[model samples]
Target: MPAAALKNKPLPTQSTAKRSVLFDSPYAPMAKHRLPAGRPREWYVTHNRRLKAMRLAIALLDSGVYLANQAHDETIRSTAEEIGVHPPSNTTCHMVRALMRYSR
Candidate 1:
């Protein structure tokens, strides 16, 4: 969409948590470590996945593991757990792909 055509449209809402675990994931700019007051748990749940994924991606990057393809998905998940991000979900995996894309 043209920038002029997109004027007045609301940007998508993002997480507002206080991210204690800092990293260089692309999503780092948006992810926080704690939910803002008054936000519903449901809202937090929806947004926190990206933060978790960001942490996992940072761990992989630190380990020199750049994603090559889906073949890297399992490695990503294991890294997630090793880094304390348990039960890595599909959304987290998607974020990992995104991180790798930007890095490349």
Candidate 2:
């Protein structure tokens, strides 16, 4: 992908084809954090900070502050720790990788 290719694209909309593709593919897995059996019906809080952290990580990597393969895990771990969110482990990384592949 070229830098120019992404330069003028509008921000993605929720109903975009990419989202449809995600929902239709194997990348769309069940949520890991579901209410247990017999649990009261309650809304789970959205962790907006997690998305922020991911965006930050992506930005830093794009800016050449960190190599994609080198220090990526540690950077994610440290950033998550700073934000008090548990860092995703290898399993989560694998899922993310699959999702990225599907999106591309």
Candidate 3:
């Protein structure tokens, strides 16, 4: 296909585009917002708290699982229970599969 004949994807769904701020076209002026100086939102704090707890759970895996690089298993059970976040699916297959992939 020729570059001139290519088509762009439609605008993403809200949940997908909400996190992006960059504009792709010269004709599209960026949306401007004036945030009041100082102070962050309560929801941001709660989000950070969950992220911290998730990182702690990943660190706990170091003793038993030998996952390569920064490949953290997103599904953590015990730490999730302790922190009162969503519980992982009650399965051990994820770790075994991760190990099998790394060995090859």
Candidate with top TM-score is 1
Query: 2 or 3: which has the higher TM-score?
Result: 2
Q: Model 1: per-residue lDDT, tens digit, 61-93?
A: 665666546326566666654455566777778
Candidate 3 per-residue C-alpha lDDT over 1-104 given as tens digits, one digit per residue, 9 for 90 to 100 = 89965866344223221122222322222255654546578656544454444443343343233343333344233334333345444233344334434554
Poorest lDDT segment (10 consecutive residues) of candidate 3? 14-23
Clashing pairs in 3: none
Task: Evaluate all candidate structures by whole-model CA lDDT and list the values in order.
Answer: 0.59, 0.40, 0.39
In model 1, which regions exceed 4 Å deviation?
A: 1-34, 40-42, 68-71
Give the TM-score comparing model 2 with the true structure, all chains together.
0.29
Global lDDT for candidate 1?
0.59
Cα lDDT of model 2 by residue, 1-104, tens digit = 98886765343233212111111111222245644455434322224333444543543344334444433455445433433355667544443334333432
| Clash pairs detected, candidate 2 | none
TM-score for each predicted model, relative to the true structure: 0.56, 0.29, 0.24
Q: Is candidate 1 or candidate 2 better by TM-score?
A: 1
Residue 68 CA displacement from its true place in model 1, Å: 4.7
